[model samples]
Target: TRATDSPSPDVSPDPSPSEDGDNSEGAVPEGYLGSWSGSIDNASGHSTRELVIRQGEVGEAVLTLTAEGPLATGGTYRCVFEASLTAEPAEGEAVRIGPSTVTEGEPMASCTPGSPTTLTLLPDGSLSRENTSSGEKLTYTKSG
Candidate 1:
C-alpha cells in the first residue's frame, strides 16, 4: 500500500494475445513473466516482497509484501495487491500494473488499498518494483 497523495498511474486492461504472432499488443514481453522477489533492510525496517506473474485474460500479477520492525510500526504486516499488466511494454520499458486491490492484510487505518507500481527489468535480470504513489522501490530476482 502507499500514501494517497501521489498521482495515480493510468490503469487499463491488458489485451488478449493476437493469433497472428507472438508480438501481440498486450502480450507480456519475455523477461516479464514468472515469479520475482526482493527485500529491504534499513533503519526503517526489513521487508520482503514477492511478485508472481502469469498469462491470463490479460497478464495477471499478484504482489505480496511482508514486513517487520520500525517500518511496520514494530509489528509484522503483510499486504497483497493484485492487478493486470497495463499493456505490452516495449523493450527496456518498465511494465506497469495496478491501482491495485488490497485482498488481505491491511492494518487498521493503515495501508492504502489502491496504489500503482512500475516494474523495470534490470540488466542483471532483477525486477525493480517502484510504487507509483510513494516512489518507494525494491529490487527482486526470479524466484523458484
Candidate 2:
C-alpha cells in the first residue's frame, strides 16, 4: 500500500471513536476504530466505498460498508453491507480481520452476502480491505 501523510483531497477523515469503553476480546484495535473511505477505477467502473467499523460482540467486530458505482449495462448501483468480523492472528503492526459474514444487505442480488473479506491495518495507519473471492483491493485512510 502507498504511504502518505494525508488522505486524498476529496477524502475526509472521520477519526471519531465509535464507542467509549474498555477494549474487549475481538474488539477492533483502537487504531482501526472509525470510518474509512476509498475509491477505485477498474474495468467494472469507478466506485467509491466507505467502511465503518465498531466494536461488537465478545468475539466480533461490526462492519458497515456502502459502495456505489456505475453498472456495466448503465446507470449506477449502490450496495450496503453489514458484516460480522472476527480478528485473526497477525504479526507486527498489521491487524487482520476475516471470516466476514454478511448479516444484512439483502434484497440486492448483486451483493455478496456470504463473501469473506480481509481487513488489514497497514503500518502506515491506512486500512486495506480485500475481497477474498474477487480479489478486489481498496486502501482507505482514516476518515476525517
Candidate 3:
C-alpha cells in the first residue's frame, strides 16, 4: 500500500477551546508540531514508523503515520496511517489523537485499524504513543 493523503474515518474533528479558554485558535503546542520517527517491535517482528503533525486552521491539526518493514506474510510492506487531533490539551497534558485508520497498506500487509492513540510530548524532546486496545507502545524521537 502506497501512502495516500486521503482522510481517515477516525480523523478527529476540530478541537474546541477549553472551558477555561486557555488555548487560542490554531495555537498548537510547539512541541507537537513536527516530525517524529520510531521503531516498533511486536509479535510480528520489527518495523519503523514515522509521524508528522501539522497545524491546520485555528484549533485544528492533522497527523499522519507511515510504517514500513517486512510483513508477516513474508514480504516487505509499507502503510500510511492517519488521525486527527480532537480536543485541546491542557498545559502539560498529552496531546489527544483520535482513533487511527489505515489510509494505505502495501499489497501483502495486514493492516488493522486501532483505537484512538495519545502522543505524549516528553520533556526531553521525545514522544511516546500507547494504543489503549492493542497495548502496542512506540517511543519516537523528533527527527525534523
Clash count, one per candidate: 0, 5, 4
* lDDT tens digits by residue: candidate 2, 111-140: 665466777788898999887788877899
In the order shown, the candidates' Cα RMSDs to the true structure are 15.7, 16.6, 16.1
In model 3, which regions exceed 4 Å deviation? Answer: 1-27, 42-45, 57-61
Give the alpha carbon lDDT tens digit for every residue of 76-129 in model 3: 788887887777777888777778788898862466666887778777888988
Clashing pairs in 1: none
lDDT of 3 at 62: 74
Candidate 1: residue 76 Cα off by (Å): 1.4
Using TM-score as the yardstick, the better of models 1 and 3 is 3
User: In candidate 2, which residue ranges exceed 4 Å CA deviation?
Assistant: 1-26, 58-61, 88-107, 133-135
TM-score (C-alpha) between model 3 and the true structure: 0.73
lDDT of each: 0.67, 0.69, 0.77
Could you tell me how far off, in angstroms, the CA of residue 89 lies in candidate 1 after the best superposition? Answer: 1.7
Q: Best candidate, TM-score-wise?
A: 3
Model 1: ten consecutive residues of lowest lDDT: 62-71
Give the range of the ten consecutive residues with the poorest summed lDDT in model 2.
16-25
- Using lDDT as the yardstick, the better of models 2 and 3 is 3
